[model samples]
Target: VFCMKGDYSFERIVSSDVDCINLKDPVPLLYLKDHPGLSYNDSSYSYGESLSEFLRKKDVGNYSCYINANSPLIIRKCPYDPYKHHGDDNGKVMKNCRDNGYYHESRDGACYLCRLEGKCGCEHYGFETFINPQKTNETGRVSACGSDHVIFSDDIYSGVEVIYNSENGLNEILYLDPHGHKVKYGMSGF
Candidate 1:
């Protein structure tokens, strides 16, 4: 696929791919802005370094199967800052995933790790592990009324809006971010 190198905007009113009718014999996968800066990589038009196409699935179907506890991915700016997943420290940042996933804000060096799955596969994994009130509040106020604990993920871009695509159950899935841009990733595990 070919990629657009620099920041650019279309000057002419190229409504559809038909505008480039006189440029080449046959049109490629998508339309091009008719610029010299465009380069031929896989003979396809790309957006940026990582973007191969601009919202490839323009005619995508209905979206469903929403993610839980991860909305508007809240970034953990500092250690002292509160509002972690479970509404408290989860020990995810302090307890290295490479070492052990167990650690909590209430107690240091605790062995209990929140095993709830993480969401994004990006550099920072934003995920949460639900807590059981019966286990956490055996004696305190939790014993009066039942409630669930929610953990927060660092670098949460937004509540992950994943649409289940009927195409091929793979990477073609689209994630909608109400606050930011949507991203595509593999659905191998999901």
Candidate 2:
């Protein structure tokens, strides 16, 4: 959401879903000749006028226009170095996987770190403590780190499911031992 609290005003040009006050239409054909003081991010495709010229075209005084797409926007506030994953330094691994078109399967249901990598092997990795809320049993994959792990992983695999089991939820098989204790395998414990 963008906000301006000065001697300026703005209007949304388009919308995709709900008419949320902040949502703007996608790639709207805006007539800069009518709305003066309008500037857009058209670096690749040059708009015939200079920034000052475009602003002068609109009668609005000292206005700032923002173009926001309906796509999800994530704001991260941690001192994160995106180069590391687990103890394996899998930055290059992930990039190579993505570049070479290696796709991970989606596993349905909320998963703890051990369950995610061991039981499902969905290529996505995540972690959740007992204190966190149970994630939906939807098929998808994700990897996460730190305090914001759950939310980040959820967004990464939004609305994707691999299995369609109505009787038992996804990630249901718990690897238990004879003593009724959950067993950890394959470096699954954090």
Candidate 3:
């Protein structure tokens, strides 16, 4: 839903919603080999390295879901949907991001409030991912998502750079507009 007209077309930004690869593209890496929780390893290996070099330079530069708010394009389509919506029960988030189960298959939740599929606007940075279930995962309350269209204006997200790392907890996302041009995003829960 965010394409400020630069001659468009990653098949028209995945057909109608500029939710990065949801504005689909050539995504077949065939399981990207042994899923380090969909490849941003920490507990295991993937020494090849990529928790967020902007998803390995946007798959070696083929670009999809291009959001240039200053320079922004960082996403976590489903970091396990807030870890299975933790303690779900109509507080909200009932799970169903297409359920491929693990590695790669969830897609619905966490546009924060840009409102996926039904498509809302303000163009993202709507940040929402907060899991505190009593703080056990080492002082929780960081589910991770962010939206600040320069403090919510309605378009052209401005100035956002997140790098949570008390030892790798978000690890980077930079989206800014207002003529500075940027779009970087990375994620991890592996």
Candidate 4:
């Protein structure tokens, strides 16, 4: 069996061939010390520490290991499953759907429909009418999420007049009613 110190939390064992090896047992230093061909200067030597020290130093860190076998021993980062689904036969996200539509152990997991809607509005008008319209201001101006300037206008009045003359150009008039609703006049350009 191939074994290595994983990220400093536990010993990682990866092997396709099923064989029982009590890795929890302490690896005698004498066994490794007498191996002249094997170099101790390599990072893999860290796994050679006493069983107690190896267990104590377990945390999040990369590690390597060497065995006196023909095929050089391999060490790999263990796949972490906070939900404890590592040995599951079926590769489903959750064993069974819960109230939130995902396993309780999974973090931030929710219904697929909710996730899709959050990522992108499902309907074309759902984004334009219900979502985007709510974000517009009185002048029908909307500031883009990532930009400084307003990039879109859904003004109710598409044809309006330029009332005042300015040094730059003709300035359009935006009138507001008593109820705080913008009033638009149809007078066509300047």
Give the worst 10-residue stretch by lDDT in candidate 4: 127-136
Instruction: Order the candidate numbers by lDDT, best to worst.
Output: 3, 2, 4, 1
> 91 in model 1: Cα distance from truth in Å?
38
lDDT (Cα) of model 2: 0.23
| Leading candidate by TM-score | 3
Model 2 poorest 10 in a row by lDDT: 63-72
Q: Mark the regions of model 2 whose C-alpha exceeds 4 Å error after superposition.
A: 1-87, 109-190
**lDDT by residue for model 4 (88-169), tens:** 3332222121111121111212222322333222222211100011111123221111100011111121211122222244
TM-score of each: 0.15, 0.15, 0.19, 0.13
> In lDDT terms, how accurate is model 1?
0.21
RMSD of 1: 23.3
Query: Candidate 1 — number of clashing residue pairs?
Result: 14
lDDT of each candidate versus the true structure: 0.21, 0.23, 0.26, 0.21
Residue lDDT tens for model 1, 1-117: 234547854455435332211121111112223322223332222223111121122221221111111111111122322322211222333222112212122221111122122
In model 1, the runs with Cα more than 4 Å from the true position are 1-156, 179-190
The residue-level lDDT of candidate 2 at 48 comes to 34
**How well does candidate 2 match the true structure in TM-score terms?**
0.15
Candidate 1: TM-score? Answer: 0.15
